[model samples]
Target: MFKIGELAELAGVSKRTIDYYTQLGLLEPVRSETNYRYYPEESIERLRLIDALKKQHLTLEEIKERLQIIQNQPDAADEIVDKIEHLQEEMKHIQEELLELKPLLKQLNEQQIKLMTKPLAQQGYTLLHTLAILLGGDPFIN
Candidate 1:
């Protein structure tokens, strides 16, 4: 049982921000007989999540919708599993990209070693253009 000020301090937010969350129906903290707001331990984690979402630029309505989705879903872990699968696929692609980049990185490293051994007067004409010209430049490139 923590008071509003305590929760605010613990969560690294202001009392006004917590009050705004309550006003926006985002959090439902209990009230004492003196009509002061008190947050439970669960509210602390919820506040942390809310703060994280705000950092991601999520609107209050979007956060509320996500909360609703979690409440209405029977298997919330399903979402996690789907995300894990997606991340695995992305990881496979990233590994392929790294494999492809290895040769280029080795060549660039060789170039750097050559440049370091060269005389300072001969290091002026090294052109490190990218492979983007293979695609004839980006469509957005004018």
Candidate 2:
């Protein structure tokens, strides 16, 4: 356990910022017998995440919501790992397919290459939608 000053220093944040997060129910610290606030080691990571999200331009409320989801989902880490592994496999397959396509691409004329690329560029939006679905929908899309 660490006192607020120590935690703030370790997390590279100000004590006032930690206090504000505590007030907002973002950080929960334990009260010592002497009534001093003491944060656990995990608080350092939480503070870092809060700072990173703030840097990403998320509102405090949005950050709180995202953190709440993370806290509530006990199996999220496992799920994320599985998803990452699956994506890696998919990427490997795509890389192999790209290698196979390389010879065909070399034979294509400029006009043929342009036509092929235009459709592939349009498919990028479809890829984005697929990614959004895989990622539990777009939270930042308004």
Candidate 3:
């Protein structure tokens, strides 16, 4: 267990930030008998996850929602969170690549875009939806 300042140091955040996160229900710190808050070792990784998600342009509320979903799961919460963090990191790279292609994509008219996506759409509607959500994009963009 680490005191608030210790946690902040290890997580590379300010004590006030950790306090804010704790107040926002993002981090849970155990209160010691002496009235000091102590965070578990897991808080370091949790902070990292929060940082990564923030970098992806998710709002604090969205990050809280995602964290709630992960924590609410009955099984393997740590494992699931780890996988999600990994997925988000991968998506960030993919998003960058897609941005590089966005100019070329915008040059295509409706019919050309349809022709390009038809094969991808044929592969699976679910795939497209999943990719859209992961990339934080509109699934039905005009």
On lDDT, the candidate that comes out on top is 3
Per the 3 Å backbone cut-off, how many clashing residue pairs does candidate 3 have?
Answer: 0
C-alpha RMSD (angstroms) for model 2: 6.6
TM-score of each: 0.51, 0.58, 0.62
Question: Candidate 2's residue-wise lDDT over 1-142, tens digit each?
Answer: 9999999999898999989999999999999889999999878877766765575466999888878887787357345445555766786897798789879988999999888878866886777687676545774477
User: Would you list the rank order by lDDT, best first?
Assistant: 3, 2, 1
Residue 19 in candidate 2, Cα distance off native in Å: 0.9
lDDT of 1 by residue, 1-142 (tens): 8998998899888999989988987778888999888888767766756655565456998776665565576366345335545655765796797687567657667778566546533532221122233213444357
Q: Which parts of model 2 have CA positions greater than 4 angstroms off?
A: 74-142
Model 3 lDDT per residue over 6-82, tens place: 99998889999998999999999999998889999878878887887787678888898888876777365567557
Of candidates 3 and 2, the better by TM-score: 3
Which candidate has the highest TM-score of all?
3
- In model 3, the clashing pairs are none
Q: Go through the candidates in order and give each one's C-alpha lDDT.
A: 0.66, 0.79, 0.82
Write the number of the candidate with greater TM-score, choosing between 1 and 2.
2
